[model samples]
Target: MTAHSDSPPSSSSRRRTAKKKRSSTPSTKEGMPSRSPRALSTSLESIQINPRTPKTPRSNDRRWPREDDVDEVELSLLGEDERRQAADGMGLEEEMDYVSQPPKKSVSSKDKSAIVLLVILYLIQGFPLGLALGSVPFLLREHLSYSQLAIFSLASYPYSLKLLWSPIVDSYFFRSIGRRKSWILPMQLVIGTVMLLISFRAEEYMNHPAEHIYEISLAFTGLVTFSATQDIAVDGWALTLLSEENLSYASTCQTIGLNTGFFASFTVFLAFNSESFAHKWGIPRLTLGTYLQFCSLFSFGVTIWLLFKKEDKETSEEDINIKTVYKTMWNICKLKHVQILCLMHLLAKIAWAANDAATQLKMVEKGLGREDLAIAVLIDFPFQILGGYVAGRWSRGDKPLRPWMIAFGPRLVLALVATLTVFWFPKPPITIAFFAFLVIQTVLSSFAGTIQFGGIASFHTRISDPVVGGTYMTLLATFTNLGGTWPRFFVLKGVDAFSIATCNIKAAGQQLSVKAAECVSEHGKQACKDLGGECITERDGYYIVSAICMGVGTLLVVFYLIPTARKLQALPASKWRVYT
Candidate 1:
């Protein structure tokens, strides 16, 4: 028995001896066992109380190792100066976490080229729009009644509804040449071909406009439809071609380019076709067909150049499918900011719509010829350009849209000026004082408009997610266009509601017998007398509409716009992301 006990006898006895040895052994001072004295004591107490119980450390008594303690040890290894340097380095890393890095260098050459290309393409896009909205109405004014002209404006519906097919453009892209190029090249080719064909037929259509009005209108509608479709591709291309840092300037390019093209098609092209200008300048006269052909040739040149330019080919793997496109669009539309933006866009130009619709007629009533109107446009053009440039500069860097709110005061003042001008000068013999006032108003209004539009465009570009850029951008533009277009219906209806007659002198003459007594009974005799025998009728509709629009616009800016802009500004970049 003595020999057995001495020779580490049974397994149970050996286990007890091992436990005792482990409990007695001094644990390393650096480990948790040394630091947690309670855990060590608890183990010894539990072992003495019940040897049958398996010996285990008390988890409750064991303390976790502290980061500060570890850090202190690390610091102890270094000298005092080295420890101070390490602490400074750590602070610097923390500081960098919160600090914004400096902006990158100026835009690269490749990006500049892309911006130039975008501007040119946007110019092309604006051409058809200008011709349709500006020149066509002016050209057809003599033949078509005001109501008829308003009806004819329905041809621009394609522009406001292009979002219906924007997803298709975004989802499926040609892998060969490029996604945007494939669409742009083909659409440009088709549009140019159609314009060329129209050029050949334009003179004939103009000659018998009363007879071929429907056909001519249909042709123009087709042109607008194709132009709007191509716009989608170009807009998407702009989103992809430019980096986020340069996106805001995309609006500047668009505004300047679009306005330039508009000036060309609306003012310059119309001036070239003006009979008075042609006669006065002794310039060779050209038919509308010639102008159309010029535009067509320009389109073809642009298309050919774009065809040769290399674009980044999008892969099928990266492209969103149609279903995904719809899903993303739905998701985007659901955003709170997006909803507010859409509403703001829809209401932004409501204040100017009536003034715009009635201004031409008012000018005519005031004995201002078409040339006078054209001159006003020319005076306003430079200011428009300057406004766009200034706004672009102000909206650069970190906050591209914050400065836009400054335009509200100027815009409100302009709206008031417009209202007063309409009521103040609505008669013949436009005096020099009145003319100067009109010119000043036009210049200031144009400048303010350019700035407001530039800011809105930049905001749209900034918020649009690149994954579904075409659809998103188009939706924003569509709402904006609708705001400009839909209000015209109300304006025209208001004109009629306010008893503004569409004077038909010939019809009145037919109704009147040779006797002066018959003239008293003519249907439009009173309106003729009011207009001083001019072919227009007017009333106080302009003042009423202007007052209503201005009031509503002011209210919206105060309540809706200020708050929404504040909210948008408060959001961080992380919150701006919609897709994963």
Candidate 2:
């Protein structure tokens, strides 16, 4: 928006305006509660600050310039649209998109090319992540116990641990190659090489998992490490790649790309690789090696694309200091509110830990096919997307945590539904009704899960101070991931610890109680059957643990969590910063 005035400013008024501009603190550095009272009116009159972080100017995001932005020579370079806006406008806020900026393409054109590049980069990061997190677990569940799967889960920790090394990546780069691309080039290549190297022994690793679990875990950990490093570079690139008008698409593209990659690796791979699916459709099987090789080659393709299409901005040695980044993070963490939030993030996932980690495995043990599980997830994928979209919408505006609160109960309800579904697993030729039942539960589960995650993330985005936002967010995310992941191991172990099993001998017409471990493994259960008895769970530990979790979770959310979240969200933005 351009402003209009009838006459030029007098010398006295010019001096006064200059004095005011100099004395007033820039609002973007820290949101001061003391506004000039005209600040709101000034913002509305001109300068379209990015919607991603509202009017706040992030260290990375684009912001508009003020009174003294560009000299006359630089000013001459501005396009038709830019000159008109600058001529009539007076500088108000301290933000970034100064005069003499390059002409923006029409909004109709948007930034599709940049966004697509971002998607490809993120998709490259996600392919192996899904293989390790989703496909591997399903495959391993058939052979390994939940306790063992918990150990395998450690492969994902490299991602959770990446925050430790983020400052190094963010601070230092080979400027000639490009800030992000320097890391992206080698990281993607390494990721691809790791996947290819592991591909040759995929069958061997799976065939004798117990003997080679560490090798498999260590290999996948390396893959995740490179992916995490690539993630850092890509995220840094995104800050510059996105235009002001399409800034919001950064998160949207990430969600779409990551989930798309996951769907390909986990759902599509499982379906095509299924023996039943291949036999039913007369199609060739998709082996783990083939899938890994495909992912590897795809990563290579993206690496080649990056070489040609690297971002225009080169890295600056100006702001590259690892010590400052760490210090900034330490200051953010020292705040009382951050400490409390850290605690909340660490404790929040306890309720869903068992449900998330073990429920599907329980269903599989009761005879559900991995292919069927994949199909259910495939059908629910759209619903999950819809849920995240709707939740993202609902999470906007002042009260972002409301949808999170609403989503909480449904997750608990879905957990119960899953428990019942497993408890009532039907015999042989698993009917359509059974499949439908699982599908419904999974759909609701996906929707609730996505909604809850979106809501919390929105809250995170809302509260983050733009100055230290990247570091603050990374720290919070680490704790959040830690919360979810740390509990999964114990929950998996608990399921076995609390179980009671009995052997039913039909010939003797007697049921004899047996140790939980005796009836837990595939071989153990088979051994019980071979001894003229069928292994039956007298009391399943998963159900007991889930019930306890739900009950305890409900109380925590009601008495402590809901109130804490509401108060935190309502707190003044200044309160979240290190200094007033």
Candidate 3:
């Protein structure tokens, strides 16, 4: 729990405490006394601004202010050296309360080993999530004849509805094993088991198209449901596993692990020829069952490996009640800033979704294949890592605002890169030019995206009320899904208008040709030849959709980013939050 005082402690009192603690410790080479963990913890706890409970008392101490009942900005009023000492003392074991100061929780090696095991177990579970979801579109397109829009619509359901059950995971625990681990381990087992079962179904259902679709949908839905549940558990565990000091770094490591799993399963392996595999296996027709079976086999292998891994053994009873869970969710809603930040996060993702949708279409229209898209994503990942690293480097100081500025200000660069690419892609001097443009755009997007997420990480952590961190993040996820989906919904609906307009224009041209032939017999051959192929009207509409969507999306980002940039720029360098 964070320590809060009604009034500021006197400088004399602070100096005396410092001197006494300093005298007890060994002197450094420079003759300055080292800081004690207790003092550092005290100072940090003093300024914690609990975002969820704003009515909680504020403090004047200089450590990195947590969002717990205390405010972080107030803590930045301290001298740089003091803040640095506090920050250094905070290692991976510290509590991350949005509304209170984080307490560094020290555990034995046994417990640490448990956390390590848990990480591995959860990572294994995350793999099939990526693979299954990523593969859905391809499977539907090839076997079910589902349109791109329909695939997008269908696969999006699980992620979009994650929040509905987030509370149950947060507050409710099993009576037997433990709240988090009990649920997590079993769920992992279920996923693996289901996946394995799904694999067998693939061979049996291939010939019957209707049966194939039904079985595939069921298996896919099961995977999504459990995958989402696993995500909840993992996120909660991540919050509880580390201490205040190491939370940032640990989270980064977690992200790396999660993304590695996600990319390998979803982005990389998804390109495999599952359709052909069915044929090779002598299946009469492609079945959804086969696809599930493949994914299940892979998932089961990982699940078996994870069952023996080290994981958290501790569980608490206080964490399992529905009433307690609702309280936590309600508490998260009480934090106004968290709500705003969630909205901002949603908006940012919306921009990204729009960009991604447009980019995929444009790439195909330009005659690029899936290989090119893969290369583009591969190139973008590094830039994102670089951006995250850069932001971490620049975030050391008393300035609380510097990181925000850096985070939100550069998004326009992404918009610019995306918009400009459309023009260059078509008229590029060579394919190399097209490749270069995409690579550059990918890098910029990655950089901006990294910074944006980094900012979110810091904000969420800083404002975190440890008890409710799970709920707060889940709510944030809910909003993010909403933001991402709304734009796509509208865009998909409007696409038909563009299609209809193009068809009408082309029909008009054909009518003109008929009229011309009737008026002049000599020109009939020329008119017929002109109308024989190459529908110019259709081409124009295609270009218009590409151009208009990009133009509009980019313009929207520009407006949104300007104020965000200005605010971020105004933040002081010293107070900028740093996460590794």
Question: lDDT by residue for model 3 over 1-580, one digit each (tens)?
Answer: 0111111222322332223222322222332222111100100000011111111111234233345424234435556665555545563222223223446567657556545654564455446555554434433332222123333444445655666665566544543334355557767778877867765655453333333555566665677678667766665554345442333333443445555655555445443434343355664443445445555565566556655644543322121345545554565665544455555655664434545444454443444444455556666766656666665454433433355445444554565456456545664234786687777867766665555444443444444443333345445545644555556544543443454211111464454322221111112223444555222223223234445655554565567644664454454433332210
| RMSD (Å) per prediction | 23.6, 11.2, 13.6
lDDT of 1 by residue, 122-225 (tens): 67766776777677666665444444555666766676666667666654444555657767888888888888998887867665565676777787788778
TM-score (all chains, Cα) for each model = 0.67, 0.79, 0.61
Question: Higher-TM-score candidate among 1 and 2?
Answer: 2
lDDT for residue 345 in candidate 1, whole number 0-100: 70
Off by over 4 Å in 2: 1-111, 315-320, 501-518, 526-536
Candidate 2 has an lDDT of 0.67
Expressed as tens digits, the lDDT of each residue in 328-436 for candidate 2 is 6788898888898888877776777778878888877888887898889889877765775677788878998898888878887887777777777787569998789
CA lDDT scores, all candidates in order: 0.59, 0.67, 0.45
TM-score of structure candidate 1: 0.67
> Which sections of candidate 1 miss by over 4 Å?
1-120, 201-214, 238-257, 304-312, 316-319, 389-409, 419-434, 454-474, 500-544, 551-580
Q: Is candidate 1 or candidate 2 better by lDDT?
A: 2
TM-score of 2: 0.79
